[model samples]
Target: MEQGQAPNGLSSCYRHPGVETGVRCTRCERPICPDCMVGASVGFQCPECVRNGSGTGHGPDAARPRNIAGGAIAGGDRQLVTKVLIGINLLVFLGGLFFSGLVDELVLIGLAFDPELFRVVGVADGEWYRLLTAVFLHQEVWHVGFNMIGLWVLGGPLEAALGRVRYLALYLLSGLAGSALTYAIVAPNQPSLGASGAVFGLMGATFVLFRRLRYDLRPVLGLIVLNVLITVVFREVIAWEAHLGGLVAGAVIAYGMVSGPRGKRPLLQWGACALVLAATVVMVVMRTTALV
Candidate 1:
């Protein structure tokens, strides 16, 4: 007799006697028809077991460890996107250290977004990717270190709350906004690079998120104030314009994310993000044209 044949010389599934099946449920060890089979880590499961949520594979919570400080505050399972961003920044910095040519061609002149590049080379030559590429360039160890620390401190919780997609959108948009503002107001030949703008964006997003939750806003606000003071005091060295632009963009995007229409929050949130990005692009075009 065949492996699935019954004593009566008939081959059939346990759930559907008329249908033949050789597959068995992993948990219940019962024959399962194709229609009733649910994919599992070890093996397929029957519809009954699947309905009961029985599976060897872990669910989302298990896959992503919850933050001990609660999902709102920092310190928890590291968000992958945040980690990747930091890693990229470090790699670029490291490359610049080892390869002088890399620093000259990619970091400073080519990748780093600057007013002159955007206005002259970028607009005329159509090399606009510098707007986003510049975010990864860091000239000094401290420059990358401080910005990375900020990213690590703020990114995990923000990623957890906003989710990976929205979190990334917020970061990139903030960076673009920051650079755009810098190009618009800074010296025509001034050069700006690094993730400081994006980091500032994270801080801004956290502030708005906490406010929405009705959490005490003093800590985040104080931190922002301190950073602002530092920017103001070091006006010549620091790109305060970029920081302010990032902060405003982040706060506005966070507001849209938290205050969107019910049941369509994701859609509205993404739409708001798109609008922010579009506005930044428009700013870039206008600034480039004016400079030209």
Candidate 2:
């Protein structure tokens, strides 16, 4: 042994005693060679820690799945999209309070789902945006507040699972389905505007996403049952038709996204979601044609 070096068995790399590197695993605190070191948030980890999933061997983003080619976390955070959605809904509702004619022009006459509009004005009337705009409208303070709460509760996890683009697609498609159904079933002139349809869609999306991850479905199932009960008990007030439409649309879209093969998951999942949105557009066209 060299004069300055410790004895071979006393304090040397576990994998390479001849080498002088004195690094150790953050988790196990055992001597490790650079070859065995895995980058962790605070310090280096060992292969054993990586294999055991005991350490996030990259950083806080390590736990999130990353795109292999791009190195970006697949879903990132849920804060920005959900907050923006809530902000828009609140701003519109607030504007309606201060401006006497704003609600009539933007929501009731403009955005609320009304089959009669299609019948009287025709699809070329530029009122087609109502399919989505109505999802952001609310009749009362509690209405928007309650719906925003649902969005915050359910949007975070779903967005984290599906990523921003897909999450937004699911929400809009589900809302479209809800409004389409309402237009199909409700009286032609009846005005209906609320985020209940989109909110119900979030619930359905959450249910399907959890099921894909093989999570405990009991809590999700319970929430679904409770909401269904509320819709039934308060059918007159709830627009149960819209809720059912959004729920079915969300579940079907989620199933399509989750059931794809591992290799083609992203491509197939997004394609399936796009098809759902396209189908909703067709429904609107057909319904408007028939009504007109």
Candidate 3:
């Protein structure tokens, strides 16, 4: 017999008695078919074990450990989301290498004529997706390298601390906030692209997180000051507005995530993120109205 095949009627799947299987659930030790197997850190788990906390050796009533932001602490890779984000940016960067015109279509622009499209198109022209696509787009090696380094260094801790969902929300909202501010302030024809805004946002969030954990603030504070100085000095090259917007948005969101009463923590935390998102939308709408 094969490794996973059961002899005659020696073993059968618990969920499907007619089907024979040698594989057993790691948690409940019940024979399970491929359909009922759920991947786990160790071996496969049955549907029931996966649904409940039994796979972790805890009953439904067991109090699971939670991170600072009220997210359940689970085993396995903590920086999965961050890794995915980096992979996305790298894939986009690779695509740009092959498709030269991709940059024009994805780069952040309020209003401008695309040479490749040979038409006037931009955020004001209803292609608002550029704001987000531009977040993952990068052309130069140096540009992507610096941003990825920042992301890997800053994002891992943030994702582990805040949990994947909340950390992702913080990143996307901060990026959108940066884009909105850039659109509102920068010249309509001026094109901008990079993850600098999002990286700056992470820096801001880290500042708040350190404070919350009662860690020393001088290191983060100094870093922020240095970056601000760099932004000001290179205002012509860097989009200062984006950096400023992301920093403010990230700080505000982080404060909400880490602060407030424990009982109402989820409400207050998500409410704060919602407010930032709302504000970002308002900024974009206002800018679009003015431009169009």
Indicate which candidate wins on TM-score. Answer: 3
lDDT of 2 by residue, 1-292 (tens): 5332466443466667656545556444556667877774324567865675433346664454322111233433445688888899999898878877555444422223434333333122457766677788886988998899999988876765565777788888888888877776675556678888888988998887666544478999998999899899988887887899899888877776655544576776677677767777776766666665
Best by lDDT: 3
State the C-alpha lDDT per candidate. 0.70, 0.68, 0.83
Please write out the lDDT profile of model 3 over residues 1-292, one tens digit for every residue.
Answer: 5333456744678888778765666445577888998865324668876676554434653345446675675578988999999999999999999987898989999998877889998999999998888888888899899889989988998888788889999999888888889998999999988887888889999999887654578998998999899889988888888898889989988889877755587997899899999998899899999998
Query: What TM-score against the true fold does each predicted structure earn?
Result: 0.68, 0.70, 0.78
After the best TM-score superposition of candidate 2, give how far the Cα of residue 35 lies from its true spot, in angstroms. Answer: 25
- TM-score order, best first, reads 3, 2, 1
What tens-digit string does per-residue lDDT give for candidate 1 at 195-279? Answer: 8888899989889877654457899999899999989999898888789879988988887787633347667677778877887
Give candidate 2's TM-score.
Answer: 0.70
**TM-score of model number 1:** 0.68
Instruction: Please list the Cα RMSD from the true structure of every candidate, rounded to 1 decimal place.
Output: 15.8, 11.8, 15.1
Shift in Å, residue 108, candidate 2: 6.8
How well does candidate 1 match the true structure, expressed as C-alpha RMSD? 15.8
